[model samples]
Target: MRPTLTLIAASTLLLATACTTTPLPPQTIGQCNAEPASWAIGRAPDQNLIDDVLRDTGSRDVRVLEPGMAATMDYRADRVNIDVNDRGAITGIRCG
Candidate 1:
């Protein structure tokens, strides 16, 4: 009986795992025509950099996130996220 119970639990766990999926990358930012080079990926995200992104991407809601920071998982078609590293260099640009 114990062996049968273990088999049943293992099967249930396997089924649940198989049914789960990885979340897809945000598509809203991927669809934006904003040039990646325009944001200066290796530079600091200062006011001028922020202004450039706003002016170029035309996105009013821009979020600047430091490394390992927790950000909302919600998707915003009109929002842009700037990821910076420890040295304050821009690492990634994505749309929320």
Candidate 2:
């Protein structure tokens, strides 16, 4: 009986932790979808900047693309793509 209770408790704890979801900052498609160019343009894609955007937009994924670079064709609803020019200035922002 003790072993069975311990196993059940352990399983319950594991399932609870696994099912938990961290809350994300609120983001709207109309706003987040239009934010990339203004946020990244004339700015470098540094870690700090990336972290800021990720926090602000609550984006699940971010991809930075340089001029003429090819990216995966699969689209993700939770992703934001930042396109930069040769000078490392952001030129476009799109959401997938």
Candidate 3:
């Protein structure tokens, strides 16, 4: 009986893990910009600038997983994640 309970617990854990949602899709600079009106957006900045945005924003959906360009100079959107290069320039922005 104990062995059966353990097996059931293990199976339950596995099923719970599988129910987790997938992470957000990595987007390109052009693709992110094309989406009109996001939840947030940062000003013209490189990828490193995103670190602060991610930390302060408190949203896992915001990730600069790839290199990309800032579509807007105002850094306005529903929710924006900026990716930049070594020179402190924005490569792309994603909105959610």
Off by over 4 Å in 2: 1-37
TM-score of 1: 0.59
Q: Where in model 3 is the C-alpha error above 4 Å?
A: 31-96
Pick the winner on lDDT between candidates 2 and 3: 2
The residue-level lDDT of candidate 3 at 21 comes to 96
Clashes of 1: 1
lDDT of 2: 0.74
In candidate 2, what are the lDDT values of residues 58-96, reduced to their tens digit? 567888899879899987767777778898877776776
Give candidate 3's TM-score.
0.30
Q: What's the lDDT for all of these models? A: 0.77, 0.74, 0.51
All-Cα superposition RMSD per candidate? 11.6, 11.1, 13.4
Give stretches of model 1 more than 4 Å off.
1-32, 36-39
* lDDT tens digits by residue: candidate 1, 41-77: 7889889888788667756678889978988899876
Worst 10-residue lDDT window for candidate 3 reads 31-40
